[model samples]
Target: MLSTTVYKQLPVVSTTTCYQFVRLSSTLAAPQNTPLSHIPKPSKEDHHQDATFVEPKKSPFDVSTRIYTQQGIDGNDDARYLTKPTYPHPVFPTEECESVTVTHREPRTFGDKLSYNGIHIVRKLFDFVTGYADPSPANPKQYVGTRYEMTEGKWMTRCIFLESVAGVPGSVAGFIRHLHSLRMLKRDRAWIETLHDEAYNERMHLLTFIKIGKPSWFTRSIIYMGQGVFTNVFFFLYLLNPRYCHRFVGYLEEEAVRTYTHLLEELKEPGKLPNFQKMKIPTVAAQYWPELHEESSFRDLILRIRADEAKHREVNHTFANLKQKSDRNPFALKVEGLEEPQPNHGLKVMTPTGWERKDMQL
Candidate 1:
């Protein structure tokens, strides 16, 4: 080894050069969160090239339209239950199913008259049939539907049959004397409108299901029976409320008779008779859900549905008599919030889940 004199040269690096090196390395190793840095350094010509990647567009009406499309979107996607098929023809193939279309009426303003003890369900019926939770009691907006390709006749049928019942004839000023005794008609109207709107959405949903050929027989009967059974029991519970004591029962009876008469009159129309007597309940029930008749038959299910409605009609008549016997005005009693006496029922159906005791807390 030869020891030689070496020139000592201090190597110096420029701050700009060091910074550029660091930035170039960082640019290549892209951080996962920010993609902007991941793009490779491109030539001027490369930047001019057209990019082809695009995202798919989605429809806001997907939820509502899903029912009409055979591909159901009601939480149940099992092919066995909801068979993918084309929409079925209307139950009433001909005649005025297209007549008197339903219009979106102005929403009613809610007030004391539309209170829980007033028009809104007197008491949330906590029965076994409901499966514990009331579907959309707290948030009625969940039931809304997209207004598209709906005919005027179907709209009218839905409005008259379900929406206008309690709000129009039952609670409107000219229709009932005590409806505005407390001057809560406007408020009551609003509440009724909300209920009606919700009902409309529900009906629309069901109709959509029918249109899409998903068989809904079992659920149809269950809903009809459940509604009737619960409503009948609730009628007794309602009788105990002072508001329904005297006039309430009579009003209900009169309404029932009127409805029956109207039904008969409607039957006289050339195309209405068959629809009236042979009303398809399952088709109506499908509006509520997909899995309702997920595993049931239409022929066997319709009988129970018809029977349930009959039972409801009978109970409504009985309640009318009870209200007359009580001799109290519904509006007056409602304003006071004073409950009437409960009926003495010798027969009590013991439930497996047990009844709500006086001190029982939910």
Candidate 2:
């Protein structure tokens, strides 16, 4: 048994020594240094280029002259490049400045004046009923009424009411136009279509505000009653004098534009309203106007809505003027120097799963 163990140990030791010897011999045979010809050497063009050779084309600005240092630091050229170009601040118009230049000036027409007066009376009556109290009296800033007074809550409430009323004129006008078309076979199709589209668009605005404001049940009840009364009244008014109806809608939209502009300004001011930053845009608004989806804050959403109101104002005023000029000529109903309203390219009224559809059947 001892002899067999010694023999086994001798074979194991010899096998280990033989493996080590083979590895050592292989390492020694491998070349330590590569051949001079095989070794990579720097090319003449890379290290010894001609001193007088100039680039075929150079940048307009000298690269060496630019000092790329941290921004806003002394001796940093970045400040010069990074600074925004100074622009003259816009001189906005005030109530006192009657002669001030305005982008959308009030229409100079007898019908427009009459309509404006009527709207002013209605507004005064509404204010009385609603108890017109300035919310921000301590920091009073005036635009339409008082800018500082237009808190987020007040603005939202106003939008709720405004949208409810805005739908009235368009719906009334569209229905009247449709009836007239049916009565007279030779109907002005363009005007009818325009009225219907406007009504639908205004209703969309109402829907957007509903989502954002989430008004109280009391407010919703008030809107329902007010809308019912106003719709009938406007329908009769449109039947009596379509021109005047158009003019009235135009003026109403003007007020809307002014009101939204005031609200936008108030929102921009820091620390103006409580929980202002916490306000978010509604999903419905993002769907209707996808252009606002990138920065879908309350401010951006308001701006887009304001633009729609302005467009409506312009269209209604143009329609009023056209009605005055041509009693029944749709061909003559062009807004001078104004392009046709662009279609809502970003409108995706359908839900992702197609489970729901927007009430935009114009």
Candidate 3:
């Protein structure tokens, strides 16, 4: 029995030695037949070379070759070829990656005509208000050159005010949709929930800017007044013409995209503003967005916000299209074909299980 056990253990030990010998031979570039005792140990240079060996690029479809490659072995977790040791970078969609084409649906019915007219008038009103010139005292001359510039502080203040107004439409739309569903005894499983989600998302954006901008009491008061008035007007507009209301929100979002894009450009210009880089991302913004934690630059935050606005623009526009179709034929069913917006670009604001009221309260 003792001899039998020793014989069994000898084979296991021999197998382990053979594995090591093979690895060592590969590392040392030694002949396979070289005696184990005579095999030379690898030098530091040899180890370095082995560590940094670059595999030839193979065709992506060459699965047979790829199966033996480091990328294939690691699958999606492959990091051996990375120049720097770091987590995989998340690729946030830029303006270029997203569709820029705005959908324009011509009026095909009486309801469509009414909705279209309402949208047209409201759009004009929005433009008149937004386009009003309030020249900066510091850059009074900037207003003359087909270009106007505001300091970063001023721009952030503007964002705070705009976000406050921007959040109003989604909330109003959501509340009305909920009420409409309740009154009709039909569940709008699609639009109602989506509108609420949009409202929450826009509110979070408002809160994020509030923390970052830290507006004065006067600014806060202005936001309060604006929200109250805008909320009332939008609520009535939605009740009268839901399709038009959706289109109006879509237009607002398009303007928001342009505003954020402009802000990003300003932030990128060297010496455009002294404190652009100095400002750290707000904690709320960071918590909501994990990518911000890795790269908490203002530019990255702005880009993320812009991406959200772009999605909102698409959603509201699509909603308008659907509403138009519904209005034309009340019995018709509309399907939401738009892709679900990406999850705040992988940011977690509310807990996975439920939203915290305190975290969300404006």
Q: Tell me, by TM-score, which candidate is best.
A: 2
**lDDT against true structure, model 3:** 0.56
Ranking by TM-score: 2, 3, 1
Q: List ranges where model 3 is wrong by over 4 Å.
A: 1-148, 324-362
Q: Which ten residues in a row are the worst by lDDT in model 2?
A: 348-357
Instruction: Go through the candidates in order and give each one's C-alpha lDDT.
Output: 0.30, 0.56, 0.56
Greater-TM-score candidate between 2 and 3: 2
- lDDT, candidate 1, 1-362, per-residue tens: 13322222212345567789989997777565666656756765443221210111133321111112112222233334653323221232112221212111111223212322332252133112221222243652332353321222232232123322322222222223234324653333222332233234333434433433222233345446645654454445433542332223223223333333333334444543332233223343442333335333332222222222222233222233322322332211223332532221111211111121221111
Which clashing pairs does model 3 show?
none
TM-score of each: 0.23, 0.57, 0.55
lDDT of 1: 0.30
For model 2, residues 72-151, the per-residue Cα lDDT tens digits are 11121122233221221112222212221113435466866788899888777655544344334464454345433444
Report the number of clashing residue pairs per model. 14, 1, 0
